[model samples]
Target: MKRTIFQSIREYKKQSILAPVFVVLEVLMEVLIPLQMAKIIDVGMAGDGNLPYIIKMGIILVVMAMLALIFGAVAGRLAAQAGAGFAKNLRHDIFYKIQDFSFHNIDHFSTSGLVTRMTTDITNVQMAYMMTIRLMARAPIMIILSLIMTLTINAQIALILLITIPILGGILIFIAKKAHPHFIKVFDEYDVLNNSVQENVNASRVVKAYVREDYEIEKFHGISKVVFNLFTKAEKIVAWNSPVMQFTMYAVVLLMVLIGGKSIIFQTMETGELTSVIVYALQILMSLMMVSFVFVMIMIAEASADRIKEVLNEVPEMQNQPNAQKTVKNGDIDFDHVDFSYAGEGGNLSLKDVNLHIKSGQTIGIIGGTGSAKSTLVQLVPRLYDVTKGSVKVGGVDVREYDLEALRDQVSMVLQKNVLFTGTIYDNIRWGDENASNEEVQRVCKLAQADGFVQEFPRGYQTKIVQGGNNVSGGQKQRLCIARALLKKPKILILDDSTSAVDTKTDALIRKAFREEIPNTTKIIIAQRISSIEDADQIIVMDDGKINGIGTSEELLKTNEIYREVYLSQVKGGEDDEK
Candidate 1:
């Protein structure tokens, strides 16, 4: 875990090194000042009231104080820079890794869990890094230097302080071991809590429509209570640190006074030396306490570090082959004994042994029940996932043998669950072609039947869409998504139930527009309605994980029982509704 995180400290290596260097200098200066103070107390004030000697020592002490202050300030700035920069790079690395993920990779991780890792986990690591460079580096050096000075003054008092070290170290280690697991559980609970919030906000309309606000609040309370209980347990263990430190502190001080006082009275130890030893005692014990605090922080951040490493260590399931084809010459698709699974090998296959060939410029329709893997089949065309067995070929070349970006650019798919970011309607549509002119943008919208509704809005194409496009109707949202795909002008366009909410007339018009305006583009429509695909060149019916039948709509109705039944049911339902 340490190795994984340290690699992200690429450009910040200089700042990381400088932070500790300045911390050592600051601690050295601080240790020397106490010795000067002891001289002023025992020698200058007591013996001959040596005014000139005291003035000289005092001036030296002031200069050391200023130097320590400057060193501390510089160390603080460097630590902040290194910590924040490390986190910034880690976040960028994690997000870019996520972008490279295949469908199989995303299947194993939850959206909310990834969000928590990128945010809360990274923040924990950042805090730990800052403390490591400052307190972790400074405390040990200060303790060792102070102890050396104390031993020189008098070894007996130094021995008394030294015994306290192991006992405190043992207790702190025990506390850390007990608290570490609880900290890990705390962030896991945070993932659940964040999931709850994301679910509620995204579905607020549905919650309001069903009058389930009170239920949502109760559900939120349940998760929040779990998180609170977890943090309470972790903190209770950590809270033992303070009293342990305080007790050891007073115990060492009392022992120093009792032993050193007798030595001073017997004239074996000078008053100035005894005073300096007392100062060193405080320095040594406080250094131990600081170390304990740093240990606690590392213990907490260990869990976070592991979580971050999970993301950083993940290798994307699919990668482009060496010297892969960069251009997709055509949209022809062939499924040659293809198989797929969300799990990689020896896992249940979601799609099985499917064979279908689509010529360039042909129109195909895919109809299937939920979980029959309609979306899974279409996703393969763009290399969103690699086949578990056999091959999926585009332009007579295996998709795995093409550059990922080049493959995806040739295929445009509007997913089942689409999203519109917070931006003007024109801006969202321009996502497909950022440099698209106003004329080109309007043309796709017109073909999607979205231009009419968009113009109805006071701001037309410039109207701002709220997050998720909640301001628009479901049908309107679907049309806008289609317009975005149309702007891609891809050779192959897959609409995965994209026009479900639109009226039958509007759906027919969109299909008509596709035929007239983009005749050479291969179009695949996945729909529930039989009427949506009746005019297709070929239609496929899927059952379970296999292709049930594939033929033109007219041929399927005459020979395939599944197609015959569906067509009659829909035709009868339309007639009955006319009554």
Candidate 2:
């Protein structure tokens, strides 16, 4: 929390200064007013007829009070503005940093963990900043200034307070140290609760389908209960400080009254001096209590700050080289003994000693059973996850040597799980090429066989898609994803089981369009359905993480057992159907 507080203060250094300055002035006003009160009682009342001097002092106190109020308000406004502005920018930076993270970094943290960091964690830090500016700043200044003022009044009475202040300060520091760890635990529980809730929400359909509503509810309740328990424990510890400080102050006040009354009766102190001394003692104690409250707030902020720093300090796995050269497309890809893994989990290689070459304008097909590493192989082309061993080259140059954006621009992938943002059909399609025209969208939509259904909607291309494109059917979503990739007109296009949802007729139409419209592009199709890639110029059959066979459909049927099995499973009267 100290780290998060410092980070926020560092972000808005100018505004933080205003808080302390205003607090100092406010404390000075408070200290001076008591001195003026003593003067009015002792000097003004003692005079025979100097009412004007008393009136003047009263006016001066009022003016000083007004100035303090004005400065306090100004400082408060500045602090609020700074805190809010700092939070807004920090949230924006965290979000953008998450977006920039490569797959390696993304997989390290859960979605819920990242969400918690961005939202709940940041909010906690923001609250701490606001509270610090509003109360924490004034607390210390009041304590110090009141102490200085009290010391000038009566050394004996001030000496008693001096003893109590250190004891109260010691209690504050001890509680702060213990409470810091609890705040950390509270935040961790927050993440757990967020993760459970997010998982349940995303899988609500599955929960309903499985009729496991009770099970899910029980799971959520368990997580919520743990969060509540942690919160209660932390709050209980924090709640002790205020009451303890109040009780301590009460004890000190009673002692001061008894001792002060005896001093006045014994003529060691005058009546007005006794009254002034008591007022100063209360002021000093009250200020110390405020300081204690500030200490508590700082402890919490310090914990929050540390959590935020962990995220900001994380080093991204992938970063562009200094003055990296942009890839100049020669339309070729070569994989030379490429090996990769998800991270940690040891070297369970996704692609091992694999070699492949794709020249300009060639269409290649990759087919394999589940866990065969097809998607992982294609993902390397765009450098989504860098290969742990061996080089993946684009246009005769290693992909690592090229600018990341330049490398990505030459390749377009329609992932197996098609994702669509909320927008009009045209806008979604235009995502492939932000500057693509209406004609280009229509051409690709027609080629992908998506035009027929898109035209059926009331607004046709202008129809608004809901979040994740849930408004459309699965097949429609796949077609739109395909259309989006097509609009890029990229040099290398990867269709990863993108046609799985579409019927054979629509798939055939899309394949035909690919041949005519994108014949010059290097295409890699990863499919489970044999028919989807059976007619490719070349097909690579994979088993485990290695390529088992590389050949045309007719050649593979006679040579590769895995390819033969896949073919036989999909096509009845198999070899004869090829004729």
Candidate 3:
């Protein structure tokens, strides 16, 4: 997983390497300053006024301090540059990978989970990367060099660090192991909290219509409380880190003072050597604290790295075969003994042994009750999901043999749920064909019976649409969506109950325009209203993932039991409304 994530640091490899080199230089300057201080105290102040020698060592100390400051500043700038660049490239790669995901791949992950991985998880990894390059180098080099300096001054005081370091190290390790699992649980809770906010914002109108704002607030509070408690549990364990380090630091300092004071009284160690030993002891203990801080960051980043690796290493479930067919010849579709299941091979099939053929330039209608797999059947023609048993062919070629982009370009599907992005009406329709002319855009809107209401606005086609087209009525949104699909000029057009929101007269006009203007394109309509499909060339009756009937309306009235019952009930209801 680390190998996969580090590959995103493409162009910033130079900066990543240079930052640590400067950190090493800064550590060297810091260690030498203590040695210079020992010289100033012993050689210059030994005889009651070697004033020239003291001034010389003091100037050297100031120069070393300034050089250390310059190196530290340069290292920090380089680390920031490398970290921000790596994050940008990583986000770019993850988004491109998501674009290639098939329907099956998308179903395996929740929307909120993927969003968190791209955003919060990546931020954690970036911080860890920056610290690993800078502080990881600075802490160890400072510890090793400081220990060497202390040993040369006095061996007895240096032994205090050797013993105290291990005891402090053990405490940090125990605290890290206990706090890590809580951090993992805290991130998982973040996904649920984000999902709750997303749902409430998207369905704000429904909540207001039902006056359920209080209920939504209570539900959100419940999820937020879980996240808060998990974070608190993790932080409480980490809180032990500071006080333990302080106690260890103070205790080691006192031990150094007591041992060095005894040596001074016995005339074994000089005053200059004792002063340098105290400075080295403080440096070594502070470096250990920095190590503990880096370790904690690594624990959190390890959890986040696993999530990011899952997205980067995911092989797309579908891809084009070698030398795949590039062009769709015509709109003829055939489903030959096809069986499909959402749960791969061993699960219950949503579409069962479906056999149907549609000719080029023919208009077909499909009718079924709820959950009868109406949308599932049309989704196969565009190769949204592959068949498990048999094959789905478009233009007499198996869908798997065709390039995915070429096949989907010819088959335009306006789904059951109409969606419009935030843009002007012209901009939204232009998504169908970006190169379409202004006249071409207006023509399709007229055919879909959308131009009348759109012209009622002062800006005509240039009126801005709010998010999700919330400013428009349901029927207006439906008509605008139909106009967008018509601009595609595809070889095959599938409308899955898309006209349910419009009135009967407008629906008939749209169908009439399809018949007169684009008669050569194959059309498929799935509808709940019988009036919508009564005039089709042939209608299909589906029940329970199987074809129950297939014939003309007149023939189905006498032959198919399911079609006869549905037709009689609708006709009688129309007569009652008239009376």
- Angstrom error of the Cα, residue 414, model 1: value is 0.6
User: How many residue pairs clash (N, CA or C atoms closer than 3 angstroms) in each of the candidate models, in the order given?
Assistant: 0, 7, 0
**Each prediction's Cα lDDT score?**
0.91, 0.81, 0.90
lDDT of 3 by residue, 476-522 (tens): 99889989999999999999999999999999999999999999899
Candidate 2 has an lDDT of 0.81
The best candidate by TM-score is 1
Strongest candidate by lDDT: 1
lDDT of 2 at 276: 67
**Model 2 stretches with alpha carbons more than 4 Å out:** 1-11, 45-50, 133-136, 266-276, 344-346, 573-579
- Higher lDDT: candidate 1 or 3? 1
* Count of clashes in candidate 1: 0
TM-score of 3: 0.96
